[model samples]
Target: MKTISWGIIGCGDVNEIKSGPAFNKINGSVLSAVMRRDKEKAADYARRHQVPSFYGDAQDLINDPGINAVYVATPPGPHEEYTIASLTAGKPVYVEKPMSLDAESCRRMAAAAAQTGTKLTVAHYRRALPMFRKVKTLLNEIGDVSLVTIRFFQPKASALVANSEENWRVDPAISGGGLFHDMAPHHIDLMLYFFGEPLSIHGHSANQAKMNRADDIVMGQLVFPGEVFCTGAWCFNVPKEFASDECEIIGSLGKIVFPFHGNEVSLHTGGEVAVHRFEHPQHIQQPMIAEVVRYFSGEAAENPCPAEAGIKVLTIIDRFTGK
Candidate 1:
């Protein structure tokens, strides 16, 4: 097995804990280098993380002969640019979620991957997580899944938003829209992963708070092929008392309930309810990273989360935001 030397672009807050260190922790993977537009900060990150090298230019990192795979951790705006560049360089890519600023960009990125025959995976890492896999198993207990309700409410400047100018989540030009664009990819992807493709999509977005440039409220509905329907409501400017992150899947026999951001799942069947609790890995992305490494090594037959799947998600977002 060959080591997959990873060069990460946009070593920002997301990498501070959620993913950065996992490269070396996983066998057959190494964090060889990193890149950021700010050369001084790039070197600082390199030194603190003990990375061998750092660069101000993404191309410098991508062209590094030692790097075999690239992790594009930048905002969605540049996802297509870096992904295509890496694939063109004959290197695979593991891009962060919300694949691009919009569905069209996602299509272009997927096209590049197809043209180059290079691997491209999205960081919908939740699909490979144990809790969600258990949720998938528990779904079987729900006789005939019919409806899913998703609710994610937060006050202004929620902890998840990462208070910084680099807060790309709410910047429409960079993240495509507001909190909905930033967070919905995970829920939407998991929905498709669990229930399959939708037959129709409907949604609307509004900026009720007008606190920022992006929309604060978004409501969406999706009807899947199996008569499964999902309705989602996301509000980022809710009251402090009303903050909640929950999703419920209902079926004829029973129902399953869990938080999209939490680690507990509740199964309601028969006359009783059972709760399953899980602890996230120190690096939650490590499991998916491992699978990507195997796929990169040619030991795994397929990438864990392909561009097609991520693009499907982006398409759904387009419909939701009415873009």
Candidate 2:
């Protein structure tokens, strides 16, 4: 099998732990190069991760003949431009979440991938997590799912002001919206994965915490197929006591509670409750990164998370914002 040379674009916080090291860990993938707008910062990340090369410009990495694939870890704003550039250069791309801030850019990305015939994937890491896999398995363990609720509460973005300008995420012109576009994409995608398309969406958002010019908190109500209702909120103002991201699946026979970053879930059935701990996997990004390498080597089917799924999430976000 051919080893895919991977180049990382945007070496920032998300790259430090979430994905940067996965390129080095995958069997058929090599972390050949990384790029950041700041040469010093990029060099720091490269040295820390032991990557072979570092570039101050994305074009430098994209133009490298040794980089068979590129991973865009930057903010959602520049996803379209960088992804299109990589694909046009005949390189596969694995982009971060919320592929773009709007549906139009998402469509353009999907079209470009199709035009170039370059495989495209997104960093929807939850689909590859063990606990979420357990949740997917137990979807039918109880009975038909009736309601799904996901709650993510954290300290308001106002409190932690780091990286406010390093990335374009907080800027409405670049990021589209605040919490709704920035963080809720994962939860929305998971909802679509568990249930089908939502027929109706009714919700509201507010700049309660004054995190930015956009709404700091968003609450959504989605009516999925088969009457499976989902309600969720992205609040950055919650206290430390309630700081967590968890999803609850309520079925006809039981209820399942999955805590993010935790290995187990609480299941209650027929008035009998039990705790189920998942078998921890190697790492969150390992399988997903490996799968991409395998795909690039012609040893697998199409990438699991495609651009269409991302477009759907963007549409849902638009619905919430009346865009």
Candidate 3:
């Protein structure tokens, strides 16, 4: 309660840098334990990270009395289960994005948190990142924002080539869908943060490349309050040179341009453009984790990304993918 002693479930590649080490780096927080299905890997991670404990079973980590918090770093399929378990065990939970396999699962997790009176936050870390924060400020300066567009085009990464069933990101049963499900939460959550609740959403998806069961392309249009409109397109089968990641927000007087995965922010008005850049931290999730720690420590009332915000995003994806 005074400090966050954390246990991580499914500490894999994402945990290796994006989030795992952040628990230790943040003040009033410590990475007390980690769990992975592979005991050797779990032990190795504990050793390398100097964590005091590690477990091959998730329940053991969840049950650890020393761990006051749990981070669900597993794939979407298991997120709901572990998050429910952690909440039931009377520990606060920080779950990865895309919250769960579907909106229903997200709903169940939210219910569990409510029942247990435990805090639950989603790792929509972009909400706390500097680049996105700058974009938000620019949106305000641009006057009454009326339109927004999100575009992500990338060639198929080698890892998404369906090398094995173990590559769960492309496996619908495990990942909820494909890379869009994996990556779109950041953009979608940012939209929610910046624009408030969506008035309506219309979406379509297709597996253009036939790379996997999940869609390789998705497009959506969302209408928000104040007659604000937004459109987004994500395509994973583009040529290498054609690859791009950008979001443009236009208002009556000017526009703001930035990328969800990049650091540059461009502001345009009066026929002039200004560009600003930011470098991400080595442990990219640290800033957000620090905020979560502060929330858990009772120094802050609001979670940076609460379970409700995460559920809204999954609902949007579910509406698009029809799942």
Score every model by TM-score: 0.98, 0.92, 0.97
Query: Please, what are the lDDT tens digits per residue for candidate 2 over residues 51-73?
Result: 99999999999999889899998
Better of 1 and 2 by lDDT: 1
lDDT of each: 0.92, 0.82, 0.90
> Tens digits of per-residue lDDT for model 1 on 1-323?
38899999999878988899999998889999999999998999999999999999999999999999999999888999999999999999999998998889999999999999999999999999999999999998998999999999999968766554566677899999988888889999999999998999999989898888999998999999789999999999988899999999999999999998889999999899999999999899999999999999898998799998888998998888889
Considering lDDT, which of the candidate structures 2 and 3 is the better prediction for this target? Answer: 3
- Tens digit per residue, CA lDDT, model 3, 1-323: 77899999987877887889889888799999999999899999999999999999999999888999999998889999999999999999999988999988999999999999999999999889888888888887788989999989889883333233277988899999998998898889999999999999889999998987889999999999998999999999998888888999999889999988878999998899999999999998999999999998899998888899988999999887776
What lDDT, from 0 to 1, does candidate 2 have? 0.82
Highest lDDT among the candidates is held by which one? 1
What are the C-alpha RMSDs, in order, of all predicted structures?
1.0, 2.4, 1.9
| Residue 314 lDDT, candidate 2, scale 0-100 | 85
What local lDDT does model 2 show for residue 202?
80
Model 1: residue 179 alpha-carbon error in angstroms: 1.2
Evaluated at residue 225, the lDDT of candidate 1 is 78
- In candidate 1, which residue ranges exceed 4 Å CA deviation? none
At residue 53, candidate 2 shows an lDDT of: 92
- Tell me model 3's lDDT, rounded to 2 decimals: 0.90
